[model samples]
Target: MEDTNHKQSKFQRVLDFIERFGNKLPHPFLIFVYLAAIIIIISAIVASFDISVTHPGTGEEVVAKSLLSGEGLLFALETMLENFTGFAPLGLVLTMMLGIGVAQGVGLFDTAIKLTIEKAPRAVITYAIAFVAVMGNIASDAAAVIVPPLAAMVFYSLGRHPVAGIAAGFAGAVGGFTANLLIAGTDALLAGITTEAARAIDQDMLITPIDNYFFMATSVFLIVLLVGLVTEKVIEPRLGKYDPKYAEEGILAQKQEKVGRIEIKALRNSMIAALVYIGVILALIWPETSVLRGEGGVLVPSPFLSNIVPIIFVFFIVVSVTYGISAKTIKKSGDIPVFMASAVKDMAPYIVLVFAIAQFIAYFNWTNLSTIIAVNSADYLQSVNFVGLPLIIIFILVMGMLNQFITSGSAQWALMAPVFVPMFMLLDFHPAFTQLAYRIGDSSTALLTPLNPYLIMVLGFMKRYDKRSGLGSIISTMIPYTIALMVGWILLMIVWFLLDLPIGPGINIRLDG
Candidate 1:
């Protein structure tokens, strides 16, 4: 029996090792979409199973709900179709990526990286690396698109392990993406759901992107510290000894576009235009009679203040116009539509995927089965009357463990929220606080998982520098960061909970009334 167990462990290790290598050979997005398809099928099957649990609210035992039933499947299809037609982030992403794509296509991103490498103080590399990782999300592709290769080049240039550089950059990009300081797809989705939950208690919960700014801004530093320590102290050291062969080959990373004279002019114009736009916006919002506010005053409750969405629209428009004019993409105003059209074209596939995803999410919720199970599960726990803080900690750990399987934070939140939000609410915890907890849990595991499509891409890049690199290599490298991050991050949440700090504006872990 002992021999058999040992052999099984050895075989498992070999399989993981192979999977790591296999991962390097596949494209990140391809693997993501592929696995997404698998997850969809598996989740659908999981949903289809007639597993049962008692209802939390009523303490009544119940059977698992069936999506196969009439009305269930119909509801699913209808919801998914709706997602395809309206409210998909596809359009927003398309528009944003156009500006980003053009910027990259024109060579500014590479220039930006070169500037960082040239000027960034060596003492601050960790934060600089992490900061670039954070801001890269502005393009949403810069991290995967730019960071790894750039890191490899920088490391090789500086006489450090190129794999360490790639690993750190890869981790920062994907992992940091999970938490953004402002409006993003995750924020939008979470906010929409938050509005839903808040309405249950108070019809008006105008939670905005900056709703949790206070905590999140602070979280940025905490994460940077955590990532920096893990990367510098652990990841880099373990990766040791720069491969001189890599140096001999002189395999420096490539830049797509050079910020030549044309791009420089475009960049200048764009910056100037962005500032001008901000000045006008600030002038309007800063004063009482500027007419940017609501009905109470010229600057009060007015459409200008409420029109944040259009501002988001105008921001892209203004920047795109400036960049295009300077770069000669737009000779006249008429050229603007062409750029916009191109942007929209890129989003069509993402739109399809989202449409499918949204349907799965909405359909699962409508069935009431997920909520029922969550409630019952919470009830069972409550019946035992376990320690509150411990239970929360345990929940966080469970969320971390599950993150290895489910990589999409928003999708996972969509499913988990409908369950935990209501269940935690019953336990006197506010939905926002619970949502925040879910974010931390989801993020810490993202870097270490094979299921993360981006991780596969990162692995592939790692192997480029070291042919022997594979899945086990990626996981082994990332595990230290993951373990370190999990410990510190969970502790931060614990302190926050104990201190009774507001998770966000008017949002608490426990509800009053």
Candidate 2:
């Protein structure tokens, strides 16, 4: 027991140091602002030396442009507004949120979660919560806030360790964040940033939101199994028997809310609506002569691919409205627009962040620094013969470490995709593949990072179960999930790579083999 306490003390110290260091860092928006300024300064210095590289695709001599010069200043002044408005992710995220906002606002998502958990059989309650949590990414970050507390309540009612339930829900909701059975808002957000980055190498390249669908869809099962196993086999056993003395007064007496008939009816109606909507979409795209089909009836580079964002918007709107009507959450048609507006209002911070990111990306592209860095880095990797699984594993590990401090997936990808996407492309890896690898690393480490706000939220839930719980307790419980996820996820990626499977529809792992 002394040795175990010693190990825990050592771990606590490490977590303390991490939290302190993370607290001292600037906000993500400020980080981008500082980075944009640095890029401008670096552009001037590089241009003064006339440093250049041969463009790998065009074979043209590429020279860096000085953002500090007269012409550069004119360009910046003219493009400021255009950059913000034309930013790829801005519209995609906003549009998707319009539908999602209404669904969440109408209580569709919350009711559905309650309905699923309350109906789960006693024999599979743990697995059910794990599955729902992992699949909840379809509802965006709201899952992080909703799942853990609800899971804890269910566990308490079932005579299980509530803290263990918190761990399981968090492990799936945040740690398995990137793995979803369907294309989510995250897919749109990240794909937009990736398309902009890939432009550095191929100007016409456009990465669709579904480019990583197959890989992510498959990962959902892997994450469900991993989270369930850790929760029951590792975390629950470690937590031992629940002690009422450690819990807050009266908390142990609280009962889980039973799912009502109205909620059941609403969920059933909404599910049926969702199926009909999917059927309509398939009917539109399944025929050889369908307007959604490509010239040769191919799905790739087709109207279906290009129109996925709008499809997501309409689908959510349909399903949510059905539930809203049945649940009496939306008494009038006007409520739909109000819900969408509220959703966009919630995205105000993201909108502001995008402004800074747009300028940084525009500046990076205008200066040709992205191209220069990518080409040179690609050449170096090739020269060392480190251009395969070994290189891919290293990239995933580096991303996992980076995720510890920079917790926002979009922000980190915005900063990284410009360089890594094109660099990997030069090494014969597809942009989609690079994005897939990044998601694996990013998701696996999300719960382990003290910087993730959701972890603190989970800590709050833990304290309700055990008043003595601290950040170290939450971190220790999550450590097993993070390690297991990283290893399992990375191994999954390796197996996918070795099997030479497509990550998405018509999206190969390599540009050419």
Candidate 3:
């Protein structure tokens, strides 16, 4: 027992160190501010060296330009406002959030989550929680807040370990964050950043939100299976039987609110509205003579794809408003704007962070630093002959490690996409493929990070059942899921690579091919 206690103490010390380090880091907003200043200084230093690289696509000599130079200062002063307003992700995220905000405000997301798990068979309860949690990401961060507590209630009612349910829900909500069956705000946000980055190499390149649709859609099932398996087979068994004595007073007596008839009616009406919306879209794009079709009637890169964000916005408005009216959440048309405004209000922090990131990316591009770094990095990789699956895996691993400290996927990608997307493009890999790889890495370690706010939230929920629960207890329980997901996702990527399958509509794995 002494030896076991000693080993556990050492493990706890390591976790404590990681938490301290992560906590010492500044907010993501401040990090970007610091990065913007550092890049300005670095650009001046590199420009003084007169170093340059030949752009692989255009064969043009790209030299680093100093932000301190007169021309650079003028450009920065002139483009500061344009950089923030014209940041691709700014409008995309806000537009999608408007619709999502309505859906959440109307209780559509909460009702759907309850209906999914409350109706599940006892045998598949674990799987249901995992599935709903993974799919719930379509509702955005609200899922992270809503799923775990409800899942724990469901688990406790069924005589299972409530902490196990929390783990499953958190694992699916965060660890499987990037894998969803439908195109979500994350798709638009990430694609916008990727498009901005890819333009560093191919100025005309535009990455659509659906660029990784096929891969992400397929990954949903894999994540659900892995999360369910880890929860039932490993986590539950390790947790053993739940003892009510460990639970806080009155906690066990508290019951989850059952889905009422009004919610069910609202969900049904919303589904009908969603189906009608989709049917109208299909009718508009189904015919060769349809206006939504491309120049040659191609669906990909067509009017339908180009206008996907608007379509998503309108669809959400229609369905959510329908549900809101049916559920009495919206008494008047004026209430719609109120909900939309509230959503944007929640995005205030994101808006501020985007301002910082936009300036950083704009400065990086103006200085030609992105192109210079990408070209030389691509050259070095080629020199070492690291140009295939091995290189892709290494990149994914690097992203996973970075995610430990930088928990925000968009922030990390915004920082990384500028450099890595173009480098891979030079290596003849598609920007979509690089983005897909980044998602795999970014998501696989999400639950393992001490910096993840949702992880701490889950820890708090766990302590209600076992007051002794701490960060170490939650982290240790999550380790199995994290390892299984990372390995499983990497293997899935290997298969996708070997198959050379189209990741999305008309998006290939390799650029030249």
Candidate 4:
């Protein structure tokens, strides 16, 4: 007991230092503004040096375009408003909250939680939550917004630490984001970029979104086990026991009505409505003649997949409204608009943060520094002649470290793929293999990065439990999972390399192309 207390005290000091350091920095919005300004200055300096890379596809010279130039300045002024509006997460979050807010306001989520916990075995609840969070990647942005709070409610109902629940959910939703049992929106997005990069070298190279499906599916189990172990053994224990006496006012005193006949009926009706919505979706896409199908009768690049965000919004709204009416929590249609207004109101801070982040991303792209770094780094790696498993391991490490600053998986890949994918193909490695390696690195350290919007979003969730919780607390809690995932993923890559395993459907470790 004494030793444990001593260790915890030391850890607390470290957390305190981290919190102070992070707190000393500007707000997330201001940080982005500063980054944008820095990019402009750096762009002008780099552009003067006459640095450029040859586009492998067209042999065109890709030069760094300085944001300080007249054309660049005009572009920035023209696109400033468009950048914020065009930012993907902004719309996704706003629309999702509209649907989720109705359910949340009507107390459907609470009743549902009570029902789920009453039947689920305590021993596997942690694993189950983590698994569902991992699978929620199929819904894109929906998982990030919905899972953490739901998990926290579950833990609170079970007399466990809410922070631990949110942490586990965060780990699954964001940390294990790259690995899923089903093909996710990210898969299609990255695969398209990879194809563009690969075609730069070999026009005949073909890659599908499912290029890493087998490996990613296998990895879901590993993530579940690893996250479950960390949550139960490390996080929960560190949090110690949950005491109702010390919990927030009304948090425990607000008596939850046990799942009764009325609540049960509401749940049943909501589930049926949800099933119907799903059926309608399936009916739309079941035949090649369906409008949802993309060109050549394929699902990839389909309208259905591209429009999944709105589908999620509609699904949640329909189910929640059904439950609210059945449960008598919603007495009128006016209540829904109220819920939507409240939901967006809660997202005010996020809106402010997104504006600055959007500008920063746009400025970075305008500067072309990311592309230059990726190309130069890949060329340097090639010049070193590092090959085989060692090269694979180092590549993962470098990518993982870079993830701390560049949190966008597709953006990072867009920069690196044109260089690494073709270079790897020249080394007799397959594009799919290289893509998988990049995915592994991109995901392993995502939760540790402050630049990740989801991490910031989860911090807001965490504060509901501990008012003092900050970026440091969240990052410290997640460090174990990040390290474990990185090491485990790297080892998996090594095993795949040694066994000469196919990473996906007919995709081997190396290809002649």
TM-scores, all models, native as reference? 0.75, 0.97, 0.98, 0.67
**C-alpha root-mean-square deviation, each candidate:** 6.3, 1.4, 1.2, 6.6
- The number of the candidate with the highest lDDT is 3
lDDT of each: 0.62, 0.90, 0.91, 0.77
Tens-digit lDDT track of model 1 for 412-447: 665466567666766777666676777777777777
Off by over 4 Å in 4: 1-14, 122-221, 230-257, 385-513
TM-score of 3: 0.98
- lDDT value, residue 194 of candidate 1: 52
Worst 10 residues of 3 by lDDT: 11-20
lDDT of 3 by residue, 5-31 (tens): 999999888767778898999988999
Candidate 1 regions with alpha-carbon error over 4 angstroms: 1-114, 193-207, 246-269, 287-307, 327-343, 360-381, 386-388, 505-510
Clashes of each: 15, 0, 0, 0
As for lDDT, the candidate ahead, 3 or 4, is 3
Compose the digit string of candidate 4's lDDT tens values, residues 1-513.
999889877876764654456557676567778878988999899999988887554667768889989988998999999988875556656776787778777767666545664566888889887887787775555566777777787888788898898999889888889888755556665665576566545667766666788899999999989899999999999978765554455554433345888889998999999999999999989899788888877776577766665787788889989999999988999999998898788768767876876677667655656556655655676789777788888888899877765566765675577667877765678888899999989988888876677888998878767777777789889999998888888887788778888787657888842
After superposition, the stretches of candidate 2 with alpha carbons farther than 4 Å from their true spots are: 1-7
lDDT tens per residue, model 2, 356-395? 9988998998899999999999999999999899999999
